[model samples]
Target: MVIILIRTVKYNLSKLRDLYLHTTCLATLANMAPHVHRLSAYASQRLVSLFYMLSRKYNKLTEQMDDKVGKGGSVEHDSLAKDMSAELHIYADFLRIVLEILNAILTYALPRNPEVVYAIMHRQEVFQPFKNHPRFSELIENIYMVLDFFNSRMDAQTQNGEWSVEKVLQFIISNCRSWRGEGMKMFNQLHFSYEQESHPEEFFTPYIWRLTLSHCGLSFDHNAVNLFTVDLPAEQLDNAGEEHDEPRQNGR
Candidate 1:
């Protein structure tokens, strides 16, 4: 019976060793499975972060492109405005040159033709181009006033002096008849008529009419001619004559 007990103890020891080896192998496999799952989760998170970074970079690039487009549009608008400004400056210079040329021509040519002088004085449309320009308008108006005053003086002399009414009328008819051929049908409309009851002071009150009489040395009153003539210096007349002579010097 003692021999049987020893054999049974040895069999139990071998079964216990087999059970311990199986438990160790199963524990190692369970730990390795959890480590593998952790590594996979970490790799997936890194991939998601990389995709997010790439999307953010793409959005930044798109915003930069939009800013560049806006800047380009502004540049184009500025270029257009500069071009328009340059064009306007060129046009203004051209108009100034034209006005200068017209002024030169009218100054020299009008004095030679009384009818042309009359047309210039009465026709506001003919002088419209110079109306905006102070210097040119003043010169034109002064020339018109001078011519009218000279003609009126000649008329007054013929009316009051030894010259017969028929002879004076004949001279005027001969000299002024050429003016009717001009396109202005209103040439006949301009006539000096004295009202039976009108005061001399009342007739010369208008600035234009006053200036005309002033140039002829006629006096409605002591201060009538002085009112307009006092301010006009001899230098202004000289300057006008000099300006008129420039075109002739240039052979224009």
Candidate 2:
């Protein structure tokens, strides 16, 4: 279910965090999900791909917005320009939220889920480009901390030796005991909260509105107390409405 939701909403950045939280809930339920680690591995990789893709789009949009502003495209002077300018900021925030989700997984789950550590270890190269990214650099720092920890451990293990997927996996699982202490001390010291949104309505309103409009059909009645409708016979609808309007006796 988590994989299905992640893939279904892969392009929808606004929904990814909820899916991550859903995965976390599943992981917390003991014995219910045996393959969640694999899901985490896949999710981490997919999110890495998404981060880079969105970063490129963000860079292009930033350049375009800068050009527009340079040409006297003032928000106060043009309502459309203002909307477009707001879009750039929104897109940047979306990108930041993506990093937040990824970092949250790494911070909260990497130690418990060996597969996530394994995935991050192998994908270290993909993260190099973001080290100096103007918009994402600070957010990516926490991720780099994790990556560096794994890289240092891998180097220590492989020095004057060899490397293999089995060996790496074994090392990660074997060292799980240390992750909560010295191995992940940096992670423990850092703090980030998804609940710290200053303007949550900005995020929640659009998400709820989009989900409702998309799933509950497009026919919304502004005057109706109930906003949505269904295809029902007029007789049945009247009866249903009467039943709904009727007052109920206590406990009856």
Candidate 3:
């Protein structure tokens, strides 16, 4: 059952990776010049939905491991690592999928003006979903930031302050690209054991806050369900046994 669950999550990740790379998400919510406002709402909604899916799956896997040991029974190092190994690797890839989606949307789909954000915010359909913005805090915070930028532009003549959207957006873009690169690097380095030659923690040093706030990116490692436990699965042991049993190619 656990293996099946793992494979199902793996399949979803595979599809998400393809979709992220191709930028084919939200097909029905296609990019029409006049519908930029509507598209932004849809994109925001999509981001929240994806987060729910991935986090729920991760929590489910963690719960499954917890279930196996008779209600937190003897969750020792080896048992925890065994169950969580596949999930940690998958979590890295899933996070990369999310970052890629974010980069694509922010790069190509942000509203060109403040009125578009108003259009989105004021729309009857969007109003209800966005009304409870705090519920989708992470995604909505980003929407609010971008919308605030556009709103300031709209009210610029009346305001006395100066700000550069270009610089801020550039800061955001650089962080997205850097974080995406780090996510991919982490995916490539899939070993989750604490004792690996280089600890997985080496890949996850968070960005210092001296830069723009938007660079915080997804705080998955810190906030979400983590694969911090340790266990070796029976399959891994079986594979090790087979490897030991196999004859050398040159009988050496």
Candidate 4:
């Protein structure tokens, strides 16, 4: 009877191990299934493809804007504006599909990968590829309005003189930087162009500032003197001299 009991115990242990192994295999497959399915089922839909085409057109518009502005010509502005408006309508349709994708991902896929969802949520340029599209003008305008409001509040706190051009430019750069992550590739692309442009930094500095002011119901004085000078103070000059002297001493 003791021998019989030992044999039964060994058989049960074998079954338990088999069961655990099977369960593990199933769990791994379950984890991998979604990725496999997404890859296999992926196909570019009409709406998405249309957006891609429009994005290229919008890029050309941006180039045109730069060219026209550089040449000091207004003739192309109206044509560019019209094209941008038409592209915006197409972009709106694309946005609807994107929204649906976001909703589905949030409702279904987010439980498994919350990090991706969070990244998408915080990204601003998820919609930025459409920025040059006329459809995105309203959204861009809304963003400008919000920034304008913030600038106004800052102006009030600093009595209109507290914020320097550098400060405002820094704020814009910071806002743009916060968009770095998945789903914000469009914004990243736009930023790349902005950085690559040969336009004078001073031109953009005041242009952005004036844009914010105009958005906030304030007319910027185009002739308003820049109180901030690029020149360093006398102390900084002295420090530079000392640094130069130290380098010479080291050479000696």
- Top model by TM-score, which number? 2
Q: Rate the local accuracy (lDDT) of all candidates.
A: 0.39, 0.61, 0.42, 0.41
Mind giving the per-residue lDDT tens digits that candidate 3 earns over 1-252? 222333344455657544332222222122232233324333444444554456566556766766766564554556665757566456534544443334334334433423233333333233233334333334444445544444455454343455355444443334333222221111121112223356645444322321222355533332232433223347767887999999999769
198 Cα displacement, candidate 1 (Å): 72
lDDT of 1 by residue, 119-223 (tens): 333333444444546434544454344445546656656354566545543444455533322221111111123335557565456566656666877545433
Model 4: worst 10 consecutive residues (lDDT sum):
185-194
Residue 154 accuracy (lDDT) in model 1: 62
Using TM-score as the measure, name the better of candidate 1 and candidate 3: 3
Best prediction by lDDT: 2
Candidate 1 deviant stretches above 4 angstroms: 1-77, 113-123, 126-252
Residue 55 local lDDT, model 4: 48
Counting only residues 3 or more apart in sequence or on different chains, how many pairs clash (N, Cα, C under 3 Å) in candidate 4?
2
Name the lDDT of candidate 1.
0.39
Alpha-carbon deviation at 190 in model 1, angstroms? 35
What is the Cα-based lDDT of residue 195 in candidate 1? 38
Error of 2 at 18 (Å): 15
Model with the higher lDDT, candidate 2 or 3: 2
TM per prediction: 0.23, 0.54, 0.29, 0.23
Angstrom error of the Cα, residue 112, model 1: value is: 2.8
TM-score of 4: 0.23
